[model samples]
Target: MLRLFSVLIAAGLFLACLTGYVLENYTVQQRTYGGAGEHLRGAQPPYPAGGMDNIFWFLQVSDIHISRFVDPQRAPDFQKFCTETIDVIKPEIVLVTGDLTDAKERNRIGSRQYEIEWQTYQTILKKSKVLEKTKWIDIKGNHDTFNIPSLESVNNYYSSAIAHLCGHLHTLGGFMPVLHSRHERGTLELELADWMDNRRYRVLVFDHDLFSFVDLKFDKWPVVVITNPKSALYSSPAHEPLGKIKHSTHIRVLAFSPAQVTSVLIKIDGVTMGSAVHIKGPLHTLPWRAKDYSTGMHYIEVRAQDKAGRTTIIGHKFTMEEVRLLPFDIMASFILRSSHYMTLRVIFILVLLANILVIIAFRYLTRPQLKESPGFFALVNFSFHVFSKTNILYYPVLLFTCYIAVGPWFIGEIVDGHFGACFVFGVVVDGHFLEGSLTFLIGILQLTFFNIPLICYLCWCLLLRCRGAYFRSHIKYTGWSCSVPMHISMLGLLGWQVYACYLLQKTYGTAAFFLSPVRTWSVILALVLVYKAWNLNNSAIRTFKADMKNCPYS
Candidate 1:
């Protein structure tokens, strides 16, 4: 029985080691969620039960520099950590807030360098469209706006568009939604409709120049349409691909001077919509067909007339969109020690071998001397079996360490909006969780990886039994058939190192070079041996107690 126990112990230790190695080192697949190059994120469960708040609003971002030129003091900001925060959380809406690029600084005049910056932004947006379905909108951004010779050549020419919107022979004051601010101060969208009952519903367009204080749109929810809350308006033009555009759709209403000899009129090619009085303070609603207007690749012209009937027609056209998404490799910015992964397998095998040698040497040395005790064989067998010293205080530390090592793998699910994973993490690793905070790395080496095995080995030593002088060294073990046994979940969890390797390969690809099968099994081997040692000590102690009671020692 004692010899059989020894065999079982050795087998268990070897099997555990093998399981860890095989799992850790395999290669697998490339993981890219939501198509974004950088999807890495800390965990966050699902949205709270309630719907989003009305006061909340997200930014409309188009072009912001993140490369070698990021500046904090200047216009473009480099500390884009907030941007990442927004991306993972999935805000309400992000309209296209334009001009993410400049002339690239080398063009001498910023007018010619659109090719590099323009395309990159578009691709990023397309990939990051992981927000809730109804939230994403792409308004025309200035950087993406058409490059033309004059204001008339631009698609959203501000001044002339407003003049034609009023239905008068001449008009003044209204602007289209254009480049917004780098930091959206309040609600991203604003409405000024109630105060402008008499005026047309005008949506003020803001871009680089339009941001300012005292603007009525300030502090208001973006749903508000009119810019000048007190005035009603219209603007530039709302164009269609096939029909003539009415420079009448997008605009902001400025100061209203009623009865001031109105002359502005809106027309679609040949038909005139109507005429307005220069003194009309507000027009009430936007052009009848404003919402259906065409955008990029489309064109329109609005004719504006001053109070004296001095008229000029301004035209704006946008070419069809031809840009495509950027390639995914752009995220290589975070890569370190890139490789084909050649030496990983060899190193792991050698480590496993060394560990086995150490285990053998430990068993041979420092064992207690034998004594002429009748129950020695029975004690050895009983002590080496089940439920032994493995439960020593050190195990709490090891369990804590394993929790840390395996816990970070689930952070992705949390960030992507799964509440369940959060609870699971809390239950498994205690509230603080391992690898969650940054400083965990400093504390990890001192963690359980080494100590857990050491504890198990120590317990196994206590399980050995000896008899006569010739058998001076104690060595024997046993197993008990009837026992409640520890929870299987604990054993399964101990084997998690194997699963972790498979998981790594599954995420990064079977060819990924970071982990090796052997490394994973090494952990398993180490833990299993610990468990067996504890089992041996418990079995031997119980049988020794029973045998001595039965024998006539008196």
Candidate 2:
């Protein structure tokens, strides 16, 4: 029974490894959705009624962050460029989605030149005749609220409120917004009066710091513009609608933002077809196909909006029919063009080689022995030997190994010029960098290899448990109290990290990315240690019970 369970667990792990890692880039499935509700309305582009496919193009300008102080005259040049762009593309709508001006301040509280910066921004929009002629709408971004102390105030307020909720607040005032800072925190809403007749549209501002939707809602106001549906790579659709569309062809869009985008809107011909199918990630992916609609020529339009009411639109004319998949080389070439793909391939190769080396070494060193001993016992014994007082020299070695497993992230940050001596963990961090480096890959492999024996034993345990039987002779119990604190501390640290990363996500977009590998290793290492200690405790208890049988006065 135990053997059967082990086989099942091993099989499951193998399958997961194959599907999730090896074959991940082989093929991507097509996702399509039909006309949905209110969420779709804001995101989908306007449907085009029966018309011949013609060459029409549009322009998109994002993250303009126009600042007067940064470059005094660039604003005018920017306006001139916009004027030229209008003449060139003659876009249907000029969408300006947030960051109209740059605050040009970081960490220096209350020192922003908001008035001059915004004056420059407003002057550019007014001077640009193209903005007047073309339908252009502006959305508020973090920088646009330069004078507002929303981020600092809200962070303090929420932090205090959370502390109070957690039963740590003895004082009543702790629940209120902390006002110790020099500047007063304004209401985090930007009001646009009468852009529409007799109606006011309020653009709620945010710090763009959110890890979960629940945390977003806790802020009591939505902050951020809705973005277009995006792809895994945070890209818009790849296939140009210029040629005939095949049933197997995919229309992919990468629409995601730290500010949080809600829904995807898609349209076919003159009618709203459906919502864009979403694949959520740190960068979300949205995909669709023309086969979801009727065959023949159809106009495909997709729009994505973020929570802050900002919108982006894209459309193409497609001719849909049954067609074979694109050749593998063609797809591979496109995917390989991406730096991330190359990096992942390199890391995979490195890890695979490392594991192969470890396996070969273990096979060569170990002698085959016919035995019926539990693998868990051996793991516990080895761990005790390495960590016990008798092996005091190995303590520093263990610490060094753990540090190596975590050094990659810190080193990567230092190389990127984001490291500061004041960071709590003594690692450099600002949170906007999400991509990993070679060091990160090596660190993960090192950690994985260090714990490979325990990981294997855990897998074996699963197999044994699945078999529903095991030798009673292997059973043992002992005191695990001495090791409990270490295991608990590790687990507690992991939990705190997850929560901290979640809360700090908006401030540092890469918080989760930086912590992910560390958290993974911590989980694996802590769980193995805890399980080993448990077995040790059980065996000790059983040994004590056996020894009692020979008591002189039994």
Winning model by lDDT: 2
lDDT of 2 by residue, 1-554 (tens): 69569979998997798567534444444222221211222223332111212213233343455654455555665576456435433445654544556666443222344566666666776777776667665555544554343445321111111110011111123232111100011111111222111111122111111001100111122222222211112111222211222222234333434346676676657677566455433222234453465354355566677677766665644433322122123233233333553555456555545544443443344322213343555433322322332122223334534454334422222312344211112343454333434444544454454444333443333222222313232222212452255335554555754553443333333533355434344444555553553344333234322322332210
lDDT of 1 by residue, 210-271 (tens): 22111222112112212211110111111111111222232322122112223444443345
Displacement of residue 33 (Cα, Å) in model 2 is 12
Instruction: Name the weakest run of 10 consecutive residues (lDDT summed) in model 1.
Output: 162-171
What's the C-alpha lDDT at position 488 in model 2? Answer: 53
- Model 1 TM-score relative to the real fold: 0.23
Model 1: residues >4 Å from true position, as ranges?
A: 1-488, 491-497, 508-519, 526-534, 538-554
User: For model 2, how big is the CA root-mean-square deviation?
Assistant: 21.2
Worst 10 residues of 2 by lDDT: 206-215
